[model samples]
Every structure is written in C-alpha cells, then in structure tokens.
Target: MPVKVRGGLYNPYDGHIDPYSVTQALAAGARHYGAVLRPHTEVTGLRLREDGRWTVTLGHGAQLTARRLVNAAGGN
Candidate 1:
C-alpha cells in the first residue's frame, strides 16, 4: 500500500508515512518492475524521423533516437 500527500494536507487515514518517502518507494517499486530510470534529465522536444523513429532532445544537448517514446513528466 502507498500513501498520497500533497502540500502537507495532513490526512488522518495514512499511518505515520512521509509523503516524500512514499513517493520514493513508489518510484523504486515501478523501476523494480522493468522501468527505465532517468534522473535530472529534461526533454526539450520530440520529432518523428523519416524512418518512423523518434528523436528526443534534452536540456543538456543529449539526443536519443528510438522507435518509441514515452513521456512521463510529473505535473507541476
């Protein structure tokens, strides 16, 4: 089970669990089930190439081209 916390609402149902810790645990659990972990990376743009591939540009000029792309940015 996991707890959801936002802006320190202080929900009473969740047992003594920190929101940040729970978030970290959930992310780890996701990665454990075959997920790619990329930290401190930003996607600037994505474009479909002529060969039916995706080219992604990051903030640090890091570019990666792949046949598929999954954008999972947390809401601001």
Candidate 2:
C-alpha cells in the first residue's frame, strides 16, 4: 500500500469501482488454490526463531508457525 493508494481502487481509470470486493474475490481464489485466507485478523507479532522458522502471533491470541512471513497484507 503506497501513500496515495488508500482506497481499494488504486487505478485512476477504475476509481469508481470498489477495490474491497475485488480483493475479497482474489482472496477466495487464492484460498481455492491452496492459500490460507485469514481475514480481519491482526498480526500482533512476528518473530524469527533460531531454527529459521517464523512465529506469527495474532491479536485474537492465536499462534501460527511457518517457514517465512511474506507480508502481502495490504490487498488481502
């Protein structure tokens, strides 16, 4: 998310359309393609362990472990 791209529709031509729904649809497709979609969940913390794995702590008191953390969190 850039400073200028606050709303969902970051394109100037398609500025009239809502970007939120587009993002949701993409998330659904990604989930169908083996992606995990965690909506409305805030990442309270991310820590890289000595074993080279990452730990993600959610605001809801949930913890998840993964190999890496790719913070493509803006659109999804």
Please tell me which predicted candidate would have the highest lDDT against the true structure: 2
User: Residue 64 in model 1: shift from native, Å?
Assistant: 0.5
Scored by TM-score, the top model is 2
Q: How does candidate 2 fare on TM-score?
A: 0.53
Query: For residues 1-76, what per-residue lDDT tens digits would candidate 1 score against the true structure?
Result: 2455444545688668777887798789978976566776898989999999989898989898877665657846
In the range 1-76, model 2's lDDT, one tens digit per residue, is 7887765535766547555787689778977977776766799999899999989999988999987555667553
Location of the lowest summed lDDT over 10 successive residues in candidate 1? 1-10
Q: Model 2, residue 38: displacement in angstroms?
A: 1.6
Q: What is the lDDT of residue 9 in candidate 2?
A: 35
Per-candidate alpha-carbon RMSD to the true structure: 6.7, 4.7
Error of 2 at 48 (Å): 2.3
Those runs of model 2 whose alpha carbons end farther than 4 Å from true positions after fitting are: 1-3, 6-18, 50-52, 68-76
TM-score of predicted structure 1: 0.49
TM per model?
Answer: 0.49, 0.53
